[model samples]
Target: MITLRDVVLRRGVKVLLDGATLTINPGEKVGLVGRNGAGKSSLFRLLDGTLHEDKGEFQVPAHWRMAQVAQDMPETDQSATRFVVEGDVTLLAAEREVAEAEASDDGERMAHAYMALNDAGAHDANARAQALILGLGFRLDELERPVNSFSGGWRMRLQLARALMCPSELLLLDEPTNHLDLDALVWLEAWLQRYPGTLLVISHDREFLDAVTQVTVHIEHAQLKRYGGNYSRFEDMRAEQMALQQAAFARQQDKIAHLQKFIDRFKAKASKAKQAQSRVKALERMERIAPVLAEADFTFEFAEPANLPNPMLVLQDVDFGYPGEDGAGPATIVRGVNRSVLAGQRIGILGANGQGKSTVVKTIARTLAPLAGTVTEGKGLNIGYFAQQELDVLSPRDNPLEHMIRLVKETTAQGRLSGQPTREQDLRSFLGTFNFTGDQVFQAVGSMSGGEKARLVLCMIVWQRPNLLLLDEPTNHLDLATREALSVALNEFEGTVMLVSHDRSLLRAVCDEFWLVSRGGIAPFDGDLDDYQRYLLDMAKQAREAQREQARAAEPPAPAPVVDRQAEAQRQKQRNEQLRPLKKELAQIEQRMAKLGDERAQLEAQLMQATQDPARLAEAGRRLKAVESELATVEARWLELSEAIEQAGA
Candidate 1:
């Protein structure tokens, strides 16, 4: 267990935790949630022993092994699998012992070392590492690729995989889902559910917290408050508690007023002078109840567009992707895409990683031109595009006010400025609406946190009064409250919205429909996020199977074997016996898969009909999850059995 009693912690002169007390039991999956700068990360630092409390007692089990994702971008030439495998310190230690034992030629030491190595999972280390890598959305071919070869985001994923690979009693994850796609996030949620260890995760994703965490620890007003359940439960309980506190505060205020009235009116009179003094003393000694100030509600709205363009944009036979280097042909990611963005339409874009979701968004945003088709915009169409890389569109050296000033200048010069606020004071006030205020508005964008930068981007977008909004992963850096605000704003906005996000809650809230960008094309997804998740899982499974097939195909053919009829017949018989059980299991798995598939389909249909009945919908969802889990298990076993059978035959 981890315990902190009357802990006083600080960053420089700023007190983060003052007399905060918390106790987290062993094996508890906890969600540490707070505002962006609420010291969640600092608390993690304390747990990992990087920081010491300035006062009072803080204790973690002394012998607990801890694993945390490295914040630094990994720059290594080692293969991804190797890098992740090396994260298992016990395995590394065991391997070192084995090497030393071999060098010493000590029989007993060698025997013990081998046993330790096996216990450390040295034999299946690569397999375990690859499983993590794949679960985190890496392609099979990328498993053996150099770690440094990946982009920054992917390198961060590798870092996460590395941390997960480690054998630890305690795991610390900060924003683990930020770099993950929906599929990878789902996989990670499932993985964490099965983790038999203490998990402390700092995340802004509410659904993720609800799915994985049983306890929520909130940091507010320099105090740590423990809640009994998940984030949603915390919110409900917190709301109720705040309401009660506010009522108590109101009652206290009335009492204070009554006492003050008596003291003021009678203090000058000889008859009540003693009583007035007594009352004054009582008032002074009374502990005042602090008013429950509403949390900094960061809410903003899109300025009503000057013009609403029906069919805001149209993509005709579009091919979305990046241009190749060295004068090569363009690399098309999504081809023959025919899509139209109409006014007031809310479309959520869905796809697995590397499936061109961003490519499509970029093309629509005009950041990338379609390789082989025409993109026609409706008359007077104005676009507000929030890219995944918000920084790319921002001038890091420029502050929020400066960015808005420049935007005003650009729009005015282009004769597009109309009723929008253009004055510096108005722009400053507008930025304040998005929570950028005073000195923060003047702070360099580059020095700001990701959430601040994202707010600046949002502020700029809202300032444009766009008829079409294209948001790609806009909620990646936003907290739950801010995400909720965005969802509300988007819902109320009088324009079309095309969003690409891994946040299912946001997607379900904002998107009226979904478009799937897959297999070099864009099409409407018939089902909801649940179906899409299952699709992603199935796609991952197929990709793995395909990679396995490719590996088998790539292997050189074995040299022709000598024909010894009697010996071959005996060997063949032995192979058949070895394969029989495996084959039977594979057949059973196939049958189970079919049964689960049918049940899933039926459940989905039932869910569609059960929308009006909350209880039925909940039950169907639960059963569907169970079926999917079983199906996944069976499919894995089937794959393993099939591989074994093939190897046995060979």
Candidate 2:
């Protein structure tokens, strides 16, 4: 357990926490959430002993082992598997001890060293590391590749895998999903669900928090407030708290108003002079209640299209991919493509990494011309395309105002500018919508943070007033507030939107339907996010099985070694005894889960049809939520029991 009482933490002159206190119990999963600069990361630093409190008590058990993702990128030439396996320092050390003891011909020491190695699971630690890598979307062949050959984002994933590989009692992850795709993110959630540790994570992703956290700690106004349950529950409780606070404040204001009115009316009268004085004293004695601070409002709208088109764009027999090197030909990524994006349609592009999600987005944006087919667009079509790579769309030397100004000049030259000529001040005022103010607007793009750059790109996109927006991972670096702002803007926009993002909350909020990019083809994905998650898990399992089959096929046949049948039989009997209870529990949980899943699906169907009456819809929604939660819990338990059974058999 960790405890902090009246902790005061500061950096330079900025006081992050003022008398903030909180307790975190063992084996609890906690979400530390706040605004971008609200000291969430700083709190992690304090916990890891990189920072010290200026006042108050902060305590953690000295014997607790901690694990966190490394901030620094690895520039090593080591194999990726080896790099990840080394994250378990204790296991590696024990293995080294056995090797050294054998070399020294110390039989007694060698025996002790072997026992330590077995206790640390040294033999299978590499397998565990590889599993983590696979779960994080790494290919089997890439496991033995040099770590330095991977890109920066992938190296960060390697860091995450390393952190997970480490054996620890306390785990701290800061935005672990930043580099992951939706598939990998789903896999991570399941992995974290089974983690038997005291977990504290800092994440801006609301859905991730809701799925993994049992408690949410919010830092606001230099104070820490703890809420029970997940992020959604926290929001509900916080909204109620604020509402009551505001109501009490309104009542206090009304009482003060009546008292002041009486005093003002009677202060000049002779008989009522004493009463007025009493009223004045009473007013002085009254304590003022602070008004509840409402959440910051973010409202913006995309401009109406210059001309409405029934179908914004159409792709017929399109073979979309990158142009081949040296003017050979375009390499087909996904073939036999046929899609018609209609006006006011919201589509989500879904696929695993390197599976053509972005390729499809680029083809729609017309940045990459179709190899073998035509892409037809409506008359006077305007597009607001946001590339996944922020730097690709933004100039390093240009400022936000310059980007907007350049946009105006380019559009005006192309005869795409509407209404009247725009001025520099207009661009500056528009940039303020994204929280850029004063001298910040004049700063170079290279100096800006990732979030700031993302905002600037979005500002430019919205300013174009396009009828269609092709946004690829727009919320990658955005905070929760900005994400909400974007969602609201997209909801209100009278245009089409195509999104490819790992942020499930944003995807669920904005996308009306989904198109899956898989196996070099595009098709409609019929189910929702939950079904997609199951699909990803099944795909991973299939991949693992295929790899095992491939390895077996490649190996040369060998004669079996002589076995001790009696000992094996005894071992099998012991394994069965150990696994009996777990197998029974797994079967029961699976049965319950199937029933709950059916219940949820039925309730969801009812919800869709019950919207004519608000009461029916609300009740159906409530039942669906409970059934889904129960299903998730049971599924996690099944994973636990299955893993236990497998380990015991091993």
Candidate 3:
């Protein structure tokens, strides 16, 4: 559906894309993989028409629409729902026009209005909005909360939801999965699997691209290279290609050397002059092919935290709660909970928002004191904590280099290495591993992406090399690729870890056990994410069963010792049945919407490219619009289902 023909893009003297050509057909999902500063975002902008290539052509249908996932938040005071609905301003406008047309009773205009509304999927828009909101981890209550009240992570989700809501034949996503939790990530993966329109996604997540995309496009040295299959598949193919190319270059070098020797030996000999000249000419015409070099291996040298005696921290009968405003009332968030964090135990904490997971982490980190429980620090123990809000902790005015130097000294007062050993050089070398290079090292921390800041914070943590790592949603704003890389790094780290995260996959991959915090209590599970998830399902089922039993017991069989027994029984029965189907329907809609989305994308792309005849094009446009509208409708249904399910289950 889109093609970049011999594209050449340059900024000043640096060429970002040199004679690069790429083709994305309908229903093809392409992953654009590259390191930092390798033109991933620039390429997305080029496609979005925000930037232009110096040479070559970018071709798409005249009316083809495109949407890009925004990384930074736009200034807005609206709620998350409003933010998402506003993303497709065209749809909102079309809805208004369609409404007016229907009111006037103009057949032609009304028909156009229906198509517009259908294209915008006004019917299903709410469903899509709810699904996205939930998928992005927003609660029903939070959906109505003002966007400005949310943190950057939540703001990014709003942007993501907006992009997903828009109807576009082509979607350009850059690090789109950075802010999503496991549930949302899973939903997104499922959505992409069934997406029909062409997609060009830039991500650091290997497994994500592998699961969602069919093609891998690598950009390096200002050139584009295509590989069939997903990320891992591409890696294998690229490796083979590089090996073959290197062999070819080696043979060419040998031939050139031999020819040069012959030319030198026979230059003055009349009998061999013709052959020598021919060899020289051949050599002159030969275009040298430089062999590709593999990137340097990254060393994640963890600095160990200071040694402590017990290697264990325990919270004995902890009573914790959020303080009521002006001490009006006691709003207990957690109460009378006992928890033990042991040495060599990699525990994963899981819970819904506002369940006091962060509060628990804070209590353990000693950042917050328990209301009633005694928090005992293990002897000779030193803890290193990695918080989700890394950006908020740092001074925005200071550059990365300065921030690193300052943080290192502050966090690691007893850092093994004494004195600044070439601060600039050390900073550059350390930053380079995270893909920051040259002038980028000097850029203010404020200007960096969430992923960038996360990377920097992680790097700092590893540099200090703590004995026990306390990571609270460390993967919050990281791309999938980076997350996977982190998994590898954490796996290799020797120290114990205590992580409070919603990323089930990461928890499964890196954690050896689980510490589920709920209702102000910490429950330990000795298993992986699968086991933990099974446990949750079991618990939820138990809760449901308990509610049902209570309802049945509340109903009076006879009339003895009961006032209005029939009415009471009826009310209990009504309550029991209320949430059952809602949960089931929500689950069904979630799965169906993903499937329908893929189908709709396919249909939309076909409609976009099927014809040029005005009548035919117009019809196709209407159909495409309808499909998009239907998609939104599906999303809305899914949302209602989700809310219903939550209510029923509750």
Candidate 4:
């Protein structure tokens, strides 16, 4: 457990956290959410002890270990395993001791080294490392690959895995889901949900937070406030806060206006003059509702394209993978995947990180060649692909308007539209729909915030009016408000959409079908994400019950009493020292196991519901099996750990 008492953080002239006092109990999962520049990251750093506060006391238990998941990559060429395993500084010291003992060839030193290793939990460290990495979406081969080869996103994942691997009492994760694909994100959600250690995660992914976190911490006006529920519940509270403030302001204004009128009418009367003076003093004393941060006005409307044919895009047995990256047995990111996206079908892809979600998108967009498969385009179908990292694709020198014009001209050149003049007003209107206002439209795209630039990129895609849209992680850089607007626009869009995103809320809101792109094949799940999630939850609950029953069955029926009090006391003393950390770890792991079980059940139920749609049902079934397999692994590990603890206790 960690506590912050009147902590304040400052960055140059800006005050980040002002007199912030917060206490996080053991095993609490808190979601840190706020608008851009609201100091969520600053507050996180202060809590994690990475950054010192400018004022006030930060109280953290001396023995409580903490780890933070940073967004950026560390400058290192070490393999993923090295990056994570090296995080256990204590464990590393034990390893060094073991090496020294081996070199010295001393029996006493060797015995001490073995005990130290056991205390550090270094003996089974490799197996633990493998589970943590796999849970975070890395393959066994990628575990030994040099981390330098990974991009910033993948590096972030490595950082997250490292943070999770560390033996910590509290975990501070910032945008933890950013680099994760559908599968990894899902696993992470379940992991965090069951994590027994205190956690504070800063993320824009609503579903991720909703599924895992019970508390919501909002940073506003350089102060920290807590809410009882998740993101949606926080939004409701925020709305209520705004509404109450508005009402209070209205009453104050009304009183002031009435007082002014009374003052004017009764200036000559002594009693009335005193009353006016009192009113003026009251007005001066009133603390105005901190000018409600102007919420951006958003109205999204994407112009519909001309009539398009059914079966907008078709792929038959497509195979995809990064040949050398994931290892060269064809890598096979996705195999035997066949999909037909028809007009008006909004599809959302879900899977773990590194589970070929993006590969599926790239294959559909023809940006990456399918290792072996057939792709057929329906008659008159036009596709526009939006990469998750689209900022890299933008010309820094060009403004939003220029980029829009260029894309329009280029796309129209193929006679998709004959001599249709680019409409500047239409462009502006589209930009406005994405929350790009007057000056924002003219500003250089590079100068805009990530959210603003994302809006600009989305504006360009809408401007193209392609019959089929392939959007990869469309909600990545977008703010909550903008994401909501986007949800509306995508839902209203007439074109078929194949979107790859980890945002479950957006998927549920906009997608008519869930297209699961994983290790092999494309499976579609017809039905909303909510239902799918529900199915997963149910399946996990069932699994947990089964696991509990099995554990009970495996236990001996007869009980044993302490035959020797002194001997038992000695054994208890030794056991206490070893059991403390192990018990703590087991509790954390068990929580995560329960959460994972819930998710597996939900996916299974969703698969069952989607049986009517063969393609979708198949995809759901595949994902269900994958979830079950992952659940089994975690369950087995938990059993092994629990049994080990029981032995240690005996």
Candidate 5:
């Protein structure tokens, strides 16, 4: 159990929580949601006992063990598995005690140490750590790799895995899905679902919150407000609450206005002097409701492109990959691909991590060229590419204004800019749209938050006014509001978009078509996200089976079976290709379920309304029934296929 009563939390001079009270019971999976900079992290700090409340009481069960992701990036050359295993502090401590006891050869001490180690489950800790690592999307081979060898995103993932490895009663996860691809995200969800401990997660991912969190804790106006049920339920409830609050606020405003008017008219009059004085006293005594504010309504738009080209970009017999150690060798990631990007198309690219989704994006964005095929771009084609690795585009030391200015200068030098020299005023004005204002526009890009950096990147891309946009995980760091703004902007934009993101909300909102990048090839997926999830499940199962096969070493390789092996490889590729549409249909069914869920919620909300039509209520119920029937059929097929695939993979 945790309780914060009249708690005043401050960082430097800024107050985050002032006289706020909240209670969290044991085993509650709470989604901590707030606008960016609302001190959600500070609250986590409070829970971790690194920060203390300036006033009032804050309490947590003394016996409870807390586990949280480390704030710093790991710099050690430690094996990934070792790093994760060490997260079990109890196991580590027990092992140390056992070592000490053995060194002294104290029979009693050694006996006690052995018991403690056994109790701590030290023997199986490594296996548990490995499970956490694998669930977070690490390859089996990579588990033994040095931690320092991985990229920043992978390192962050490792840190998350390490935290999950810990045996704790309370777990704090801050943006755990930040670096995850869709497949990894789903895996994490499943893993978290099975966790028996209490969880308080800070995330802007609506789908994730809806899936894992049973309760929602919202921070607003320096106060904690609790809502029952998942994020979807919270949103619905919050909307209603805000509506009622706003109505009461409006009424209060009218009353205040009337009193003020009367006081103004009678303050100097002898006959009404007493009445005016009383009115003034009443106004002074009256409590005011804070005006409802939409948390930083962020909205930005991309200007229409100068030219729209059919088949804006084409990849023919493309074999794209990275160059090897020597200039003579090139390693292939995606091979034998054929695709076209047409003007005004919104294409969502989906795949498991390391399956060439980013590679395809890089190829289309021209960051890397196709190894063995021509990438033909239509005349006058321009690209505004948002790299998943933001550092590739953003200069650390440069200010937002400086970056924008440099972009214009670079474009002019490259003969890509037809506009006049960019003015500082124009740049600042543009940067302001992204909430970079006043001195903020002068702050180094490196000093900003990930969400801010992402916004700055988008700001730069918009300035380019490219005909085509290639966005790779653009919503990774964006809060729900900003993601919504981006989705709306993408929907409204005239240019073609090729987006690679794990954000289902963004994909559903912005994309009309899906492309599955898998098995060294890219194929058009005709299904929605749910089917993709099913496909991912099958893929993961097969991968696990492959690992098991490798570990068992049950079959010996034969040189004469080359043709059979080649044929097997060919069949696997064909099988993946064949599974694409079924995945798509499953995805459509998933999408339909989501829509039906939303519709049912809306109907229920309307039913509670005094003004709702009875006929409309009946019609809504009928539509819901029809949707349920269709969903049942699709879900049945989904189950049948899932089982079949599972058996086949086995």
Candidate 6:
């Protein structure tokens, strides 16, 4: 168990926790949540030993090993797999011991070292590391890529994988889902649910907290409050408690008013003067109930657009991707994407991490031109695009006010400003609606927290009064309160919305339909997010099995044992006879899979063409589902047969 009793923690002169006490039992998964700048990360630092309590007792079991994602960017050229494998400290130590024992030529020491290495799982370290990598959305080919070759966000994912690779009794994760896509986030949630250790994570992702946490710890007003059950349960209980508290406070206020009235009426009368004095004493001695003061929640809404353009944008067989480098042809990530963004439609873009969700959004936003074909926009169409790398577009040296001022000037220069405010004061007033007020609005944007920057971006978007919103991972930096507020605002907005986000709660709250961008094409997803999650899990399982098979194939073959030629020939003949039926079945499954694949592609094309015809769309969707189900069944059997044949040959 970990205990913090009467703990007082400080950052410089400001006290974050005062007389705060909390006890987390061993193997419990706890979520630590608080408002931005409310010491959640600071408390994490305290638990991770980077900081200590300023004036109280804090204790954890001395023997418990801790693991946390490194905050620093890795500069190593080591291959991704090797870098993650090295995070297994126990395995590394055991291997070092084995090397030393061999060098010393000590037989007993060598034997013990070998045992330790095996215990540490040295043989499967690469496999385990690769599993973590793949589950976090890395491709198989990236396993041997240099760590430095990945972007900052990808490197951070590798950092998370490294932390998970370490053997630990206590794990600390802060915002683990910020860099993950929906599929990767789902995989991570499943992984965390199976972790056999104490987890203390700080996250603004409500669904993630509800999924992985068994306990909730809230920090507010310099106190730590513990609650049983997950985040949803805690929210329900907390709201109920607040309601009861408010009722009590209202009753107390009435009693105090009655007492005060009585004292005022009798104080000047001699007969009741002593009674008045007694009343004063009673008032002084009373334990008054304080009124519940609600926290200042940030909320904003998009101004209704000047006009709604039906079919806001149309993609006609567009090849959505980036232009190739070095004079090469353009790279098409998602091809033949034919879709229309209709007014008042709420669409969620769904796909695996690298399957072109962002690319589709980017193409629609005109950040990337179509490699081929046309993107037609309706007349008077206005778009508000929140890119995944939105923060990078903001000038670091400028403040929120400056950013808004620049936006106004740019829009005016482009002659797109309709009835929007252009004055500096009007812009500042608008910034205040997003909680960027006073000196904060003038503060450098570079020094602001991620949440603040995200809010600024939203503020700018709202100012534009766009008829169509293209938001990509907009909630990645937003806290729970802000996300809920965003959901409400989005629902109220009278415009088309196309969103790409990993936050399931937001997705469920905002999206009405889903489009799956996959296998170099786009199609309407007939199922909901739950079905998508199951599909991702199934895909992850297949990937892991494939990786294991590849590892087995890469291993050096064992030396052949001495045997009689006649006996070997007899065994070989028996193996060949056994494999004949299996091979035939395997070949048949392959042919069926190929046929099903072709049918699926044809059905998808039909579905795309039939979007406007309800009858044709329904029929195509039904056939596609059937084809997909049969393909899955056939593929599973094919894999089984292949594995069996490989074992028999061995």
Please report the candidate that would top TM-score against the real structure: 6
lDDT of 5 by residue, 1-650 (tens): 89999999999999999999999999999999988889999999999989999998999999999999997999999999999999889999999999999999999899789879999997788788887788778899898999999999899999998888888999999999898999999998888888898999999888999899999999998999999999999999999999999999999999999999999999999999999999999999999998888765999988878889898988889998987775678989989887888888999999888889898888888888778988889999989999998988899999998898889888988888835338889788878888999999999988888999999999888888888999999988999999989999999999899999988988988899999888888899979998899889898889888888887796766567446878888888877776776677777767877887777677667667767677887887787677677767867787667655554444
TM-score of 2: 0.83
Query: In candidate 1, what are the lDDT values of residues 305-381, reduced to their tens digit?
Result: 98987889888998889998898988989898788888889999998888999988888888998899899999999
Clash totals in order = 0, 0, 25, 20, 4, 0
What tens-digit string does per-residue lDDT give for candidate 4 at 1-650?
56777988898899888898887778888998877888987777677667898889887788888887756668788878888887776798999999999999999899789778999988777767766776666665677888898777777888887888788888888777777766567667877777778888888888888888889988877888889988889889989998888888788778778877877787778878888777677768877655466665565666777768887877788778755555546567788776777778877787545567788788778777778878888888777778888764588778887887787777777777623347988777766666677887788877877777777777676666678888888887876767888888888888888888778888878876686654476676656676666655564456447656875898889776649988988988989988888788888878887887787777777766743778877877787788778778877778677878988966
What TM-score does model 5 achieve against the real structure?
A: 0.82
What tens-digit string does per-residue lDDT give for candidate 3 at 521-617?
A: 7677566665655655565446447656875898878755757988988877887688667767777777877877777777667666754567876
lDDT of each: 0.92, 0.90, 0.75, 0.77, 0.89, 0.91
Clash pairs, candidate 2, are none
lDDT assessment of candidate 4: 0.77
**Cα deviation of 250, candidate 3, in Å:** 2.9
Return the TM-score for each candidate structure. 0.84, 0.83, 0.72, 0.73, 0.82, 0.84
Global local distance difference test of model 3: 0.75
Q: Model 1, which residues run further than 4 Å from truth?
A: 265-285, 552-650
Ordering by lDDT: 1, 6, 2, 5, 4, 3
Per-residue lDDT of candidate 2, residues 1-650 (tens digit):
89999999998899999999999999999999898888999999999999999999999889999999999999999999999999997898998999899999998899789879999997788789999998899998999999999999999999999999889999999999999999899999999999999999988799999999999999998899999899989989999999998999999999999989999999999999999999999999988888998768655667676776879988888898988899787688899888898989999999988799998888788788888887899987888899988998899999988888888899999998854237988778878877788998899999998888998988888778888999999988888888898898888888899999999999999999999999999999999988998998898899999988988999999988999999999999999999999999988998898899889888877877843689878888888888888888888789779879988988
* Model 6 steric clash pairs: none
Worst 10 residues of 1 by lDDT: 607-616
| Top lDDT hit | 1
TM-score of 3: 0.72
- Model 5 residue 409 CA deviation (Å) reads 2.0
What does candidate 6's lDDT look like per residue over 212-288, in tens digits? 99999999989999999899999998999999999999998888899899999999999999999998998999998
